[model samples]
Target: MNSKPVTRIKKINMYKISIIGYGNLGFHLVNHLSETGHKITQVFTRDKTKTRISKNKIDFIDDLELLRTDADVYFLPVKDDALKEVAKQLSLKGKIVAHCSASVEMKVLKNCTENFGVFYPLQSFSREVEVDFKNIPILIEGVNKETSSVLNDIAASLSNEVIEVNQEQRLAVHVAAVFANNFSNYLFSVAEEILKKENISYKILLPLIEETVRKVKEHAPSKSQTGPAKREDDKTIQKHLKFLSNKKELKNLYTIITDQIKSKK
Candidate 1:
């Protein structure tokens, strides 16, 4: 509920940290933490070649067992499918182990050790894109008090908007995120294809897309809703459907989303 920037009122001594899966979120986290005087001792990735190097010069390891055994904290940023297996293999009795998964329950890491938690970053991560951790909201949940404080501290160090979210709430948020981010991006892909087929520049939609996002920031998304569907303009909706007759899938999506919006209204 505190909408203030991450405040490091008291600096904790740098704990030796290792990140599993040196992908997008992991890469950004390492870079962000490294700049904040946190020591990144090692990085683990299945594909060591793709990992980027920051000034701290992290040592990359391919084998999970060979990772620095003395690491005080281990961040598992790996995919959902690999989380349990990795946790099972790792001997983290005394280490603080946290994962970045939104859907997976904290209990999945029970196989690893009692000191486990969720350190979910509620943002879309892409290797090609640069992320600003200051703006990204972090959701953290720890199995124990000590682990929770440590994870909360780590999250607070990276982002201003850090909150303690339980597994149920985090999973619900993940579902909403799928609709808001993934499905919306898929709609843009549909728009891009439509423009490509009609020999129009996709750049033309940039302003409208940007404005939609901007408006949502200022107003509730439902209240900021516009277009034929929001207004229940059947004539305009029919016209738009006619324009999309060639794309069956897109037309269906438009119809379904429009119907849902109308029903909500």
Candidate 2:
């Protein structure tokens, strides 16, 4: 035999995974992971007959006590409030337990298992909409090096961009995400309402919105800024506020956001 070391490279390091919650985020992970040849050994959901998950012939148990401890990983993508309570129900010893909460730290799963981590995907997920996770950035944090390495590999397999973040940094990222995604979307809803009042088609604003997003991508958001608020045009601002005089709450929001934008200027 030749004295060459045989280096085995795994094409797909398949691991048995159990999903605790079948919500949007959980659904996305299970679907993607299952497609990649990783075995979904078990699922703990309130409803077992749910569409995509039902296709997989796995042990779909509604109770935690029925969960098999043999799976390599247990993914908890439940609501932030229920995470601690759910963690208490599971027997996750000797398994890598991970949660998909941006706000909740890895320590929440401490009672569940010592080998726990945070597998937070920095993107809003909807089951009705398809998102290519290969492009989405995934953030992971583990309690130790072994857990970290395992989580890192798992995340890197799913996303092109994988980041290791501390609890503090993750919370900061969450705050930014709320502003960038949630707040911006709410602003769009407000715009739609205002346009509807004037019988203007919301579709007309789509191009303008698309172009604004494109500019932000090409340049920094601060540099790409346009509109009256960016210019601190009090005349235009007062006119818009007067136009929104009927919707008192929305008018207040408009005033607040305009002030915030002017402050940035």
- Clashes in model 2: which pairs? none
Tell me model 2's lDDT, rounded to 2 decimals: 0.87
Model 2 Cα lDDT, one tens digit per residue, 1-265? 8889989955646788989998888888887888877788887888756744444566677888888888998899999999999988877777899999999979889988889999999998888888898899999999988788888877877888999999999999999999998998998988888889899977888999899899988999989888899998889999999988999999999898888898987
Candidate 1 residue pairs in backbone clash: none
Residue 161 displacement (Å), model 2: 1.2
Model 1 lDDT at residue 126: 82
Candidate 1 residue lDDT tens string, 1-265: 9798887766755667889888788888888888777888889888856764544577888888787678888999989998988888888888899999989988888877789999999998887788888889999999989998988888878888998988889999999999999988888988899889989988899999999999999999989988898899999999999998988988998999999999988
| lDDT, candidates in the order shown | 0.86, 0.87
> What stretches of model 1 exceed 4 Å from their correct place?
1-13, 51-54
